[model samples]
Target: MVTGQAVQLDSRSAWQRMRHWAFAHAVDDFYQGLVPASIPFFVLERDYSYVAASGLALAATLGSSLPQPILGVIADRWRMLWLAPAGLAVAGIGAGLAGLAPSYPLVWLLLLLSGIGIAAFHPAAGRDARRAAGDSATAMSLFAAGGSVGFFLAPAVATPALVSLGVGATALFIPPAVLMGFVLWRFQQRQSRNPVAAKHSGGRDRWVPFLVLTAVAVVRSVISGGIATFLALYWINHLGASQALGGAALTVFFVGGVAGTLTGGRLADRLGVLRTIQIGSVAAIPALVALRATPDPWLGLLAAAAVGVAMNIPFAVLVKLGQDYLPNRPGTAAGVTLGLAVSAGGAFVPILGILADHSGPQAVLTALCFVPLAAVALGLLLADPSAE
Candidate 1:
């Protein structure tokens, strides 16, 4: 007698969704953790110059990023449920192998391998979760925060491993990668009969908003890339801080991002994504500029935390905006927002590196401040949600 479909949210279903978010976060933590661990260490130990060393980061970014639009297109055409497990396995293996590579060329090849594998997971996982979340900003924020948590945890886990296990700790991360694949497969099978995914096969393009959003994303990433590569070095050189304190600042930066990711999403749910981005962009300017002026390590650290929060909160909300815009093509939007914008950070690391060498890190950072101002300018033109 019952012929139609049913859409209901139960406690069990909610728990499953949360688990998926954590799993996805773990995957990113593993992917991004490699940069702090392998990239710098590779350069220092090998005696490579900044420009040449940057090629490792560049390879990872170029490998991961340049493929997203194409990957999103493929996601639109085919649902590769199997890729979830396969991609994680490959990424894990590639990361582990990087430790063992006989030379720098092998490191690049391994990172590229890892990049391809990590690249496969984001778009698919994002699309699947958007269905479970039902286009809510809080849901997307929680999802994004999970990655921040993983990013924080990854270095904490790996750095100690470096002291005890030497480079082999890299390979040891493979078990978790394999576990991620299994979890995704289980979640997909359970949710297969759920009817809420109907929007996925329909239409999901908000051309104007997407273009505007991507613009801010690019500018934000340029600043973030500059920070990630040079923040620690600047602190050590100018602030008279030890290497440990500088590394701690990096932790503070990412921790603020974790806080921002969750808050940004929740605030967007209430205040709206456009509003959250405006506030975050306006708020970040002082934090970023202050780093150049402040000599006090404590003040700089506080500003760094503020910078992380102001800069990254938009990342979570922006992904949700992409989903809302392209309701049918959630995976594609997710890929472009999360994969491409985040990886764009890699492209600019070298540019800033060059500028820092010629003009000094302070000058490079000061010059980069205009990028956020641009984000603020372009963000004004973003269409209200009602348009979708």
Candidate 2:
């Protein structure tokens, strides 16, 4: 009876910690979303060209992507809980300051700094969050879903403010970062005082399967990045939809992503992680095909949502599986799956951009129809940790 009570109490405590990490993730990624959301305002207010605005995005992407793997190695070695809050604070301040910067270079640099903060936060947070999540894919899914929610909310939150107040309104987002950073700092301090042992199954690191999983993650990233980069254009240009309807389609896609992340985690609990990932990978091919073949923009909205859900159904599962495959290096695993490989997709977007330039957005979508087939092929090579 006493053991049962203690187990229940520990489970509740773990959940509470998981919630904190999830919230912090949302806040951190919100700054990421802010960059893209604010880009239009920069173009409008500063008369920046498409090239210059894209440069600003590239700045942030370079900062976030380059340092994460090294930082992940560092996190594994030192357990820098402070990085979570400090990074979060930097991300917010940098983004906030960008809106108020006088020169384009200054704004670009600030966005770069914001990206570094995001890079610094992930490996540390992933390491610690895994400690809290244990083997529950559902718990980790909540963390992943928080990011989706942040991205979904950014346009909604920043658009109205930027429309009314111009780019200066980005400064308004600074407070949440500051507040959340302090709260996370306190939360980490408390957890440190009562440190819990990390839960990792004793196993040898399986490099081959881990490599296969990374390939899968990269493919998934490319498909998702392609959709996100082009879906609105596809709606408006290809399907003859209004700008409002195009935006609505994009929103539906992101909302479906949030739902899919959560659903993946729950499915992982019931169906097992590798199986759930396989299902998602297989499902995405059909969803993307449907999106490509549909003639009506309204029908494409359903297909877009389906594509979003199917692609992300493996989102949280991939993070968890990467750790399981590399039990001795969870931080590094998370850094690669969450940061490096995901950013690799961004690199491909420029290629997609070139395609969009020549063949139209529908052609880009048609190309993406073939991308997830690679993910499915790679997924078949992934060994289930439990089965191993």
Measured over all alpha carbons after superposition, the RMSD of each candidate to the real structure, in angstroms, is 3.7, 4.2
Q: Pick the candidate with the highest lDDT.
A: 2
User: Alpha carbon lDDT of residue 301, candidate 1?
Assistant: 83
| Stretches > 4 Å off in candidate 1 | 1-16, 163-168, 193-204, 359-363
Clashes of each: 2, 0
Model 2 steric clash total? 0
Per-residue accuracy of model 2 over 191-264 as CA lDDT, tens digit each: 88987644345567788899889899989988876676567667777888875566567777877888899999
TM-score of each: 0.89, 0.89
**Which digits, one per residue and each the tens of the lDDT, describe model 1 over residues 266-370?**
788889889998988887888888777788877888888888898887878888777667765667787888788777877987877677667655666687667
TM-score of 2: 0.89
